[model samples]
Target chain A: MKVLATQTKSERTQAAILAAAEALFAKNGYERTTLRDIAALARIDPAMIIRYFDSKDALFARVATFDLMLPDLRTVERSAIGTTLVRHFLRVWEGERGNSGLAILLRSAASNEHAAKKLRELFKSQVMPALKYAGADAYAAERAGLVASQLLGLALCRYVLKLPPAVTMSREFIVAEVGKTIQRYVAGDE
Target chain B: MKVLATQTKSERTQAAILAAAEALFAKNGYERTTLRDIAALARIDPAMIIRYFDSKDALFARVATFDLMLPDLRTVERSAIGTTLVRHFLRVWEGERGNSGLAILLRSAASNEHAAKKLRELFKSQVMPALKYAGADAYAAERAGLVASQLLGLALCRYVLKLPPAVTMSREFIVAEVGKTIQRYVAGDE
Candidate 1:
């Protein structure tokens, strides 16, 4: 739920804790980041964190839940479905949020079990449903996996690995090129 | 050069160190893994690790040079190039080498600067050259980056993240399906 224009003090505290936790987890995977560190950054009492989210694990789950807010693919032209999905994700990754919540989950997954589980769950709950909802009834899971390969790979190289060529690609070029491949995975023949 | 059957005592020791180091680095990543851990696993004195390689960074560089041994894309049928590349990579990844050197490089890249630089260099020297040699000269670097997105994403999901669908995918099915996408990135019109 969007925080109302007049925010309650508790909700503001929760927001502060989440922002601090996400940045620390992103910078140093889950193992090295601690509640004390998060509390320090958030400027809240450590006990306040426990009262708000119960524990570090619970807070992590809350932080990791990301909605891609994919366009209703069923409403899009069947031929343009792939490009639309690509464009939407590009914006999500590059938006004012900078590294989206999903980026934190992915970056932390390499060394943290909780983050890895969160990553898989995010795919199952959020990504797969969107693909299936868009009319990829047959092999929807497989198709989503294929799409994940492309999208995650782009994120890794451009965002994490910071490979130069990938970092420099124009947004229009990435959408047109990556969209075609995703289009095939979503709607093209085997 | 392949180590000859007539290897000296020092050569044998160096080989043992590399094998142990690769396994440790692959499982624990570069930061959590230490020289002592590698030496214990290799049954060599820890000093020998420094004696042979001078430092963990140098030892890691030696272990991280993976050879994909891609087939000549120029020789491959233009229509079939993608599938062929996919099939070949599948073999390389699933080969007796178990976790390839690239896997270690990838796993370590997130937290280690040396590993990340080595990954970029590997792509520039090895993957980009092969793409250029295959007649992707016009957009070799960009094309290589696109291919890297698919291939690295597959490797991350299947090997590192161990995503169920990615891990369980039949070799033939992945080749047929992901290969189509790679083929597009490699030779398709921009």
Candidate 2:
């Protein structure tokens, strides 16, 4: 019962702000959307956004706080790691998870300094560590960065912009083809 | 002399518009920017944008046009080719030639329908035939798309974001490592 009631009003308000921010940011982007826009969307006062996230950058970090997990990558056969990684990425990105908004952030993160810093921190904490432990350490961080480019690029083509051929391809086909390339990236004969 | 003299005021105006659009689009993006804004930056009337480019998307397509002259790629040794291609690309993207804008368009292209369409067209015309001719017809379009992603991702991380590690690494090291991966994406160890 204590765990059930662990939810606090402030936390709920914060979550509401994040949720509203995601929709607006996704619909628009970091530059166009304002604190007031987010507040109006969340049906909360603009000050609440400042209260929870401290700044627009912090709010963006929370909105972009997603993980790229490869389904239990620790124990898989070394040969299958690449395919597994690519397939799982396609599943999460193209399926109901719908990474269109995240894709926008990734594309914009380069020029926008705030987004860029958060992205670097995210790669260091979440991505680079997993890649390092995966025994890709020789070029793990760089390779991880490269792989991110590929995944984000695919999202750009298939999810965000939605090209005809890319959109038309079945998941299995994409996994098989792109999977082969990523296979070399993570655990194949490189 | 005739060509220079024959350049009409309208032609100059159109060139100005394209120039303005490229800079603004690179700095901001497709959605956030407006014709009024482009006109203001160009010191021209907003109506000029519509008159010249017909539409924002059309103007973007015009400004984002790219040409990839990958000559005699097949005959080159596979090992050296990777490094060469990487170096060439790094040069292309880093130099003030056209690639900074190219990088932005490629990353953000997947975020917009018109831009994405143009990307697909660019691949079909510029990249696909090259790969196909190089005996990579099995999945040339997809492979080209992936390559574009890796390149754009690196540009975003290294140039636009200026991630220290990525930026610190020499062009040769990046080309050598990333070239190996790109080698696999092209035709693989057949």
Candidate 3:
């Protein structure tokens, strides 16, 4: 099912296109990135981009966009859920593949109306639904908002601003503290 | 003196320039704001921008920059400090006149390296030093980082992303939850 190694020429071309778009979008942002730039980066003709994705938005949706499906919180112990969430969120933010797709969407929110809409949608569908199913409840919404504010702010301070103390904080410490804080937000006084 | 009785031409010019810069930076970001736009908005010669601030960085330093100067935690009521802090943060983010500075700086973070550097400087000099002075010790560095992450993440999700729950959260509730969470981050239990 994994297509055992060698990709077809078209497949390789598509991957190359996606890779280029990701890098460009991550570095320059969504509004600043043009089809010409993606083509330039991918070494493909501009026509091929339209031929494949039809438009910039479609290409962006495929390349620089995504939903972060959180792991099921039901299976985990309630007390540990907050801490577990902290760890998981950190993993999502600082995952091995360099910058995250969510990070890109977040950065793009200020400049691109479309990106902002997508960011809102990700929260409505993927994020809140999952938390609701996890029994976080309606009262938990504000707390979740507060938690999200702090977590995303930390990501911004650490990666984007590169604030020293934030930049210096170890992942283990971050996971523990942030996990506990999120626990308090979503679950309430323990 | 309140200076409300006498609005000097220079003061009006300065105020107008700052307002224009704030809106443009918030919308288009630091890199995208043009001196011509600021001058046109202020109805001053573009030459005056160079005369007043020297450069965009200088203008930004004067206009779009601020720091969080936290009060001494040990002296304040421990239970109330968190709520107070969240409230203050909210005020800074939502302040009618000067608040957009944080938003512009945040938006410019990815594209403008100088803005990012200035933010780090502000954190180290203002936030870190204050937290350290209040009671944060050797391990305080990382703790503050975690707290910032939580706070900023929540802001980005709520304000920048406009996530539903984040968007709808009342100011009072956010302060209660976020403030308490921050307390735990800095000085409370595991």
Candidate 1 error regions (>4 Å): A1-36, A39-62, B1-63
Which whole-number lDDT from 0 to 100 does residue B83 have in model 3? 72
Model 3 stretches astray by more than 4 angstroms: A1-63, A96-99, B1-34, B37-63, B67-69, B72-74, B96-98
Those runs of model 2 whose alpha carbons end farther than 4 Å from true positions after fitting are A1-64, A96-100, A107-111, A136-138, A161-169, A188-190, B1-61, B78-81, B96-99, B107-114, B136-138, B161-165
RMSD of each: 9.4, 8.5, 10.0
lDDT of each: 0.80, 0.67, 0.69
What interface RMSD does each of the candidate structures achieve?
A: 0.9, 3.3, 2.1
Q: What is the interface RMSD of candidate 3, in Å?
A: 2.1
Q: Per DockQ, what order, best first? A: 1, 3, 2
* lDDT, candidate 1, at B179: 84
The best candidate in terms of TM-score:
1
Q: What tens digits encode model 1's per-residue C-alpha lDDT throughout B38-146?
A: 9999999999997787567557766755777877777887888888889888888887656455665676675455667888988888788778765455777788899
TM-score of 1: 0.72
User: So what's the TM-score on candidate 2?
Assistant: 0.66
| DockQ of each two-chain model | 0.52, 0.28, 0.45
Model 3 error, position A156 (Å) = 1.7
Where is model 2 chain B poorest over a 10-residue stretch in terms of lDDT? Answer: B105-114
Error of 1 at A188 (Å): 2.3
| TM-score for the A-chain in each candidate structure | 0.68, 0.63, 0.66
Give one digit per residue, the lDDT tens place, for model 2 in B139-182: 66666655655665566667666665677777776787678756
